[model samples]
Target: MAPIKNGRLLFNEVPTGYPIPGRTTVYDGSGTIDVESEPLNGSILVKTLVLSVDPYLRGKMRAPEAKSYNPPFALGEPLYSHGVGKVVRSEHANFKPGDYVYGSLLYAEYFVPKDVSYLQVLVRPEPSLPWSVYIGAAGMPGQTAYYGWKAYSKAKAGETVFVSTAAGPVGSMVVQLAKQDGCKVIASAGSDEKVKFAKEIGADVAFNYKTTNTEEVLAKEGPIDIYWDNVGGSTLDAVLGNVAPFARIIICGYISQYNGEEPYGIKNMRQVLTNRVAINGVLVFDHHARYEEEFYKVVPKKLATGEFKYSEDITRGLDKGGEAILEVQKGTNTAKKVIVVAND
Candidate 1:
């Protein structure tokens, strides 16, 4: 095994506002990964590679009193997120020294997780696909779209499904999944390039919401049966206004309001009652039990058969992790923005 060291992204103090500048402290491998070298009888030591920088992570950076779910990133401590890595050492009976794994970890090169019950060990490494896909298509975003489609929206063939943030990891998958179900998919992206990518991924209609008014475009597009909302705010309000009766609005995320000081309000929620629409907020972790069964069972099969497609925008280093995360929120990334911790 390679020599273990301490490497991490650290913050001095939590930010109180937006456009956070160079507050991150980057530590190259230099210290012990854990206080104890031996796993607590059932733990594994993973060497992290790719780390995910998601929009929701911004919420975690705020003061704990500000929100729920995940707590604030501790001042002067290593930040953490979902990452793909290899098991360099293991004491757990289920894992071996050379096995590959993917799970939550501190933003460090090596992670000694005492409780790896939640971590998944990769059985087959596919050379055809990049390891980063485990963070996208075969990872959280994929599961988000998959379970969101099957459980909440229950998208049907010949229906018109509208998706916001259509070029993102989850949004792109929703677009392709809806298309494969024989639904006419309309997607809204933040830029022309993202719109083009959405169309390339099989969205029947793709529009840049930054240029065209969402309400105006949806008005011309007519009523939609399903609304897969990733960017809430005005886009969701517009979608609510144009939704068909018995439509399903999947509340995947609210990226637009993530950075705002004041909460953005939606003015058209009455449509939920008037149109008998069903709106559901989804968290991918809620469906962890069926993750492998669903991804490997359905999504991969479709991808292999050319029925689904996905794209990623990878940042080369952990030093750029914060920048990559900010870029996604700013809609600067055309696809899933991931930070590659190690190439090999």
Candidate 2:
């Protein structure tokens, strides 16, 4: 067979408002790596299987650069995301062809490694397990959920826990963990379908925040003990006013304010002061000590049994990444959004 030519999703423009697919993101260009040639020293050639489209990447798309934890994607550079792939060629000692790996890579169908020292060759999951799980549940999103929820929320059994945006990758996992840990989980999503999906995944009560009055709903749900804060706009304000004393508010994400167009003002600082709620932000890397327990012992067992379920809204082909990201940015994606480059 001939060598495969690869297409790439490039960051074409930085948007002050919401990202426009074809304008801010362009997918017209491609680059081909001749398989006949060699990869760099210790570089591995990988055929992309799954590419993660996370909300955080939208922040990175800006060029002038916000004061962020990660750098902005350079203009004309291919958009990069968390990706899982199979090694097609390797120039390293530890990696070999046919091994599965996951790391940050461009939205290209294949890797042309010049400086990818951060890539890791992963061990294959069970034959029955879907390889795409590495890009979602067993990957960064899940890790973010697991560590973030446990580390900050410190939720106890029989506690009333409320999670906003409960249908997202991290939020959905947070819902299940709170439920399985014996907490009474009350979750909300922007859409009705997302609210239903949250209920299906172990939330005791799930409501469409767009349709339901958030304050009225929480007023009935009573004094939430833990608020796994995902959307940090008016929702955070509502949680702050409605939570119990000493409640823990875990700041995992702020999907509502990502586009930087409509900045929400939080006016309920007095509630936090009176109630003594703890608001803590989480980064998945800060809790790496639990990685072994989660990857090896916990998550696999939960997956093997019927105790856990994860949803992935997989868009096919690398060309669709631009549109998929736009969907993610607008609070429309109901599941973990990943681009399926190839799934064998």
TM-score of each: 0.91, 0.95
lDDT of 1 at 145: 89
Candidate 1 residue 170 C-alpha distance from true site, Å: 0.1
Pairs with backbone N, CA or C atoms under 3 Å apart (clashes), candidate 2: none
Best by TM-score: 2
lDDT tens string, model 1, 177-202?
89878999889998999999999999
Q: How far does residue 97 in candidate 2 sit from its true spot (Å)?
A: 1.1
Q: State, as a TM-score between 0 and 1, how close model 2 is to the true structure.
A: 0.95
TM-score of 1: 0.91
Task: For residue 299, give model 1's deviation from the true position in Å.
Answer: 1.3
